[model samples]
Target: MKGIAFDALVDLFPGLGGWHYVPVPTEVRDAIGGHTTRGLIPVRAAIGTTAWDTSLQPMGDGSHFIALKAAVRRAEGITVGDRVTVTVSRR
Candidate 1:
């Protein structure tokens, strides 16, 4: 249940072969903010539910933490420190 960072997200892009370059989108690029500490996190389930869970997979190693800006819109019941699932609305 760890959040991904920009460094990680970069690797998960479409293409990576030689002469192949699937660049990061503007939304993701803007969200990264040039750092690399944060990433595009996708919440698994409804927040505040006991069955909440999360995971993080590295996409790339940018050598630093990336700053991300995104909004969250949850319709389920959740609370701070409740350890519920979360989702980012806009990046």
Candidate 2:
């Protein structure tokens, strides 16, 4: 099968823009003693995002998924500059 160009992929899925942004689920945060403060996204100055293991798959991976901070940065009311912060749990 032929693969489509990277830039042309977003045209297929309206939900997807420049990057995939998952809402930081509370369950994951609650597992690790929760965040020090309240509000979505443990980090500061964030609009919307969640701590998850993967950009495509955030579900199913208990005690295995690497929670990271993801935020959507938009340009001209669009989207860009998505960041990821991977963390390791202490055993």
Candidate 3:
């Protein structure tokens, strides 16, 4: 699966600080339905030549996406707007 990286603003409970993430778009999720598990999807994410293990998250509305860790982003020299390719399969 492939997607354009973008910053996702996360809003937690009241008084809690929000966070940001780079998400996998809905089309990518649709491309890997067989890998979904209880709304969470495990994936091997890569940008350019950098890769890492991570999981995809579901929005409250049922759309699913993934977050790129800061380390991965820094190592890959990627930020929001960068394009990434992700691989999902049974372990």
In terms of TM-score, the best-performing candidate is: 3
TM-score of each: 0.20, 0.22, 0.58
Residue-level lDDT of model 3, residues 1-91, one tens digit each, is: 3533433432232355433345455656666553343477766665556767777777666566566666766776655555555445322
**Alpha carbon lDDT of residue 32, candidate 3?**
55
Candidate 2, after superposition: displacement of residue 23 in Å? 0.9
lDDT of 2 at 37: 36
Give the alpha carbon lDDT tens digit for every residue of 7-53 in model 2. Answer: 11111113634333333334545544444234322322122232222
Candidate 3 matches the true fold with a TM-score of 0.58
- Model 3 spans > 4 angstroms off: 1-19, 34-38, 81-91
lDDT tens readout by residue for model 1, 12-54: 2235432211233334434424334345443332222322333
Candidate whose lDDT is highest:
3
Arrange candidates by TM-score, highest first: which order?
A: 3, 2, 1
